[model samples]
Target: MSVRELIVLGSASAVPTKTRNHNGYLLRWDGHGLLFDPGEGTQRQMTHAGVTASDLTWLCVTHFHGDHCLGVPGIVQRIARDGVAHRVDAAYPESGTVYWRRLRHAAAFHDTEVIREQPVSGEATRLDTGDAPFTLTARRLDHYVEAYGYRLEEPDGVTMLPAELAARGVRGPLVRRLQEDGAVTAPDGRTVTLEECSVRRPGQKVAFVMDTGLCPAVYELADGADLLIIESTFLDEDEPLALERKHLTAGQAAAAAAAGGVRHLVLTHLSERYGDADEERFLRQAAARFSGEITLVHDLDRVPVPRRRAVVRPRPAE
Candidate 1:
């Protein structure tokens, strides 16, 4: 079976607490694995989470903050050490190119050429990964420093209806031909169209928003996403501080998820001040605004993307 889930390697915000590590999240979507915001200690965290450098196909950095990008050197060196042959594309705000370069080669030990740098710029940009399973887009966010949010959207497809195919006596190779050509002549000489035997299936979407305050781009990135991994660095009581530091409160993150029609909201990047005891308060604050599913993540937690919404087509007039 195809696996789709978010593995939380580390979930601390600015500092590492006794329980939480710095920000690090790995999104596993079928054949693709995207590592986001690898903060300090992410290399060891990956081992705890049972993920290897080979599992990473893409590396995404929301910003160049020490708590967000400090793990880049270790992860990059590990990739080279492990001899990961597959191309690993890394994307971040173009404004942070200097920081990225410094971190990527901080202490190179036998470097590998498999890592590709694909820095993003502008208000909203579509990344070119060339024939990827989903379309990857980046949008600017409201933060003290330059930051970007990422969205992965799969293309819509048709789900074949076995009943419809059986009714038309279309079996085996004929079904494949109909799907490929949109229409095929059955053995009975009747032409059957793909539309007559399939239902529209909306593709799933996953959004990653980190280190950003309330902004229009946040909503755009989270729009209609099946899963949204966003930072909730503060509770409602600390809204002023959150705004000052360009971070989201739990309520704000949940409100954005609700506005964007996100199905599952995985909240992480919590401030170190809020210990394990304050976790429930975060959930309460978020639940008050967003009725959808919400999760207050911890290190090594796995969050599965919600199942696709069912598409109900209205029958034609009788």
Candidate 2:
């Protein structure tokens, strides 16, 4: 079975509280793992969260914020220390090349694994890993610095119906032919079209938006995403402070999710002032604005992606 889930390694803002650490999230998508914004103490947080360096295929850094990207050196060091042979792709702002260089060589040990360094130069940058299930796109967000939001979109898939095939007497090579050609004539003189048997379902999509004020691309990247991991740093009462800092409050986050047509919203990067119960309240405020599933993420909390809704049977014309 393919597993898709988000592992919240840490979910604090600038400060680490007794329960929450800084910003760190791991997105496990089937065979690959994507780690985003590994803030301070991420190396230990990963250990506590039961996430291994070997599981990471991509490392996405939204910006050069210390609380967001401070763990880069540690991650690289750990990967090299573990002797994992797989090449890890690291994406961040191209302007941070100097910072990246400093971090990459920060107290380096014997380098073992290959780390591919790809940087985002401008707004609306797209990077193709060539073999992953989805394409990674980065769009600029409204922040004090050059911050970007990342989105991953998996390709659409076809679900084969056994009953439809059986009724057409289509089996073995004929079925494969129909799948590849979209239509095939059966052994019997009957013709089968792919559309007749299969339903058109959209592909699964996930977006990660952090440390940004409300922006149009935030909605663009998050639009109709199956899973959206967004930063909700403050409650609605602190909207002014959030706006001054170019951050999103819980209500704003929810509104963005609602506007973007997100199915599941995982809220993170919370202020330490909020208690556990307060987090729930803040999330509920967002939930009030958006009618989808909401998760108020905590350190080490795990959230599974909601399964896609089954195809709705079209009503026959009266």
- Best of the candidates, lDDT: 1
Model 1, span 56-95: residue lDDT tens: 9999999998999999999999999999999999999999
Candidate 2's residue-wise lDDT over 199-269, tens digit each?
A: 66678899999999998988998898999999999999899999999999998998989998899998889
List candidate 2 stretches off by more than 4 Å: 310-318
Top candidate by TM-score: 1
Candidate 1 — what's its lDDT? 0.93
- Where is model 1 more than 4 Å wrong at Cα? none
Worst 10 residues of 2 by lDDT: 307-316
Q: What is the lDDT of residue 165 in candidate 1?
A: 95
Q: After superposition, how far is residue 283 of candidate 2 from its true place, in Å?
A: 2.1
The TM-score of predicted model 2 comes to 0.95
What TM-score fits each model?
0.97, 0.95
